[model samples]
Target: MADTGELKQLPLKSLHEAAGAKFGGFAGWSMPLTYPAGVMKEHLHCRDAAGLFDISHMKLFAVSGPGAAAALARACPIDPRALPIGQAKYTFFLDENGGILDDLIVTRTGEERFIVVANAGNADADEAQLRAVASAFDCTVEPLDRVFLALQGPAAAQVAADAGIDGADLVFMQGKETDDGWFISRSGYTGEDGFEIALPAGVARAVAERLIGDERVEWVGLAARDSLRLEAGLCLHGQDITSETNPVDAGLLWAIPKGLRSGGDFIGASALEKAISDGPARKRVGLKPEGRQPVRAGAALVDGDGNAVGMVTSGGFGPSFGSPVAMGYVSVEAKEKPILAEVRGNRLPLQIHPLPFQPHRQRKG
Candidate 1:
């Protein structure tokens, strides 16, 4: 068994236990794996209605200085110089070899201040990298170990609207502050309309209670979180991406800005440029299993001749789709046709399909 003492607790630790959550150690935190409703039910609930997730374990940091944007550009692949205030962009922290260290959301708050949200598992490394670069410039990086919540689903917009959130004005990848020291972003892991609210520990708990007070909202856990992200075609930090995977190979080439392509002197630009021009040896893709049994991560993919071509990174029984779905890398040659996954020592047929197994019905209208 994993050592419980080594696991960290979020601000809502007791509340999760009170709700009868099944716990698991994720990124050193004692996170809820699932609730009584189970992963399937919670996954469906988030797709159809609103589901509240305690995402407080994610690392929130603020970097401020006269040259903050330029300093950030030195560390990330995105062109922070062009990022408008109140806007956020999903980008990656590239290593010296052009491989991803972590994927993050960066928001420009002021002329000299920006807010960066990193993955919970890579928070320490991300902070260290940021500090190492920031030291050269006259900037201060402050890590906020606060609470965050993601309220996501088709009904998420309505819930936030009812709470006087003016969600219509907040477009995707945009953020605004509420009266209670809360930062609300119209972004989420599920392919649905939602908001990620970051606030102080005390106020975050209160906000969660208020949102859950509504009949439409239900508490979701990590199990559902994984399935939802898979259905949404989003990549998990350690699973879909790692220091071994480049942005291009992970199917995130769009994240590389045009300015950064040629003249941009960011870290790993040369390798990334080479990969962009030559193309990666293998690319990430989606798969739909033929049977009810889910194709889990590490499951091997074989070609028609039974040659190992790839492996599954994330997979599960998609509750919304009513079948098994998966996402992973495949050889460039295998991209044109159907592939098979080796599960339980048997070759199971799988069809290559487009990502986002489920459609996102956000509040765009």
Candidate 2:
């Protein structure tokens, strides 16, 4: 655990404190780990109604200028130039070795401007990498000082409508800019029909208060957020996907359009092409441990004969699914073999389940 004293605070720290939030250190930020309702209740609440989350710790950046899209394309595997206005595409920043540096969402706001949302832990490094990639192009990477919020669940749309934020028409992966300083996206990590809103820090508190004041919306903390996203099969950067994980092995090749698969001038293109041709040594997969015991990360996975196969990266109980869930990487040959996770000096049987323990309810139209 990181020292809370040394962690940076969120802009809404006071608001969270007033709401009975328990603070913890995550990615150098003092963030709310759980609210009064607790992780289980909060997780279930989000699935049933609306759950509001303070995700201001994530880094927001505006990359604009005449060459913005072209330059961004050099850094990411996706072609930002192809992104239509008001649409966002999930993508990754890969190193020269084809390893993922960070996973981010890029929203095309204008012909030459885009908004990037990156993980807090990799914000600084991602910004530096973006600047370097845009150096030769007519682009400028400017960090935004704003408060980001996610309102997610089955009733999220109705809640947003009641809160005076009109997101009723925005389909999944779409975004719209309001005149009131709100950049709203119809997307979330929780695999629910939701909206991620970015607004000025000055108005964040009042806005949060108004939303939570609604009977349908509850304050959800990071702990429940992780469980929610895990159930949705979203990858956390430092854990499921990392500096050592490639798109092919991580099952993220879908992010790359078919047109860019054969060739592109992007970084790691050759390496990624080679990886696709030769196939990855290890592939990320979902694991369902037998029994009710949780199989945590760093636990070694083995074959039926106890041969080393892989290791768990992310693991915990899926509150919505009501079972233990995990994700890990395994050698291609061993991925199909019977697997077991070593927990507390005991080997536990595990089944290879499909990704996303919970069904995604994101709005399609």
Top candidate (lDDT): 2
lDDT of 1 by residue, 1-365 (tens): 36678888888888888888988889988898899999988988888789999988899888889878888988888888788888888998898778999999988877787889999999999999999999988889999767899999988888978866555677778876556556778888888889888888876666777888888988999989988989888999899998899988999988878777653667888888888888888999988988888899999999888988999999887888889999999999887766899989898988887988998766553
Q: CA RMSD for every model? A: 1.6, 1.1
C-alpha lDDT of all candidate models, in order = 0.86, 0.92
**Off by more than 4 A, model 2:** none
Q: Could you tell me the lDDT of residue 248 within candidate 2?
A: 92
What is the alpha-carbon lDDT for the whole of candidate 1? 0.86
> Tens digits of per-residue lDDT for model 2 on 313-353?
99999999999999999898997789999999999999988
lDDT of 2 at 288: 93
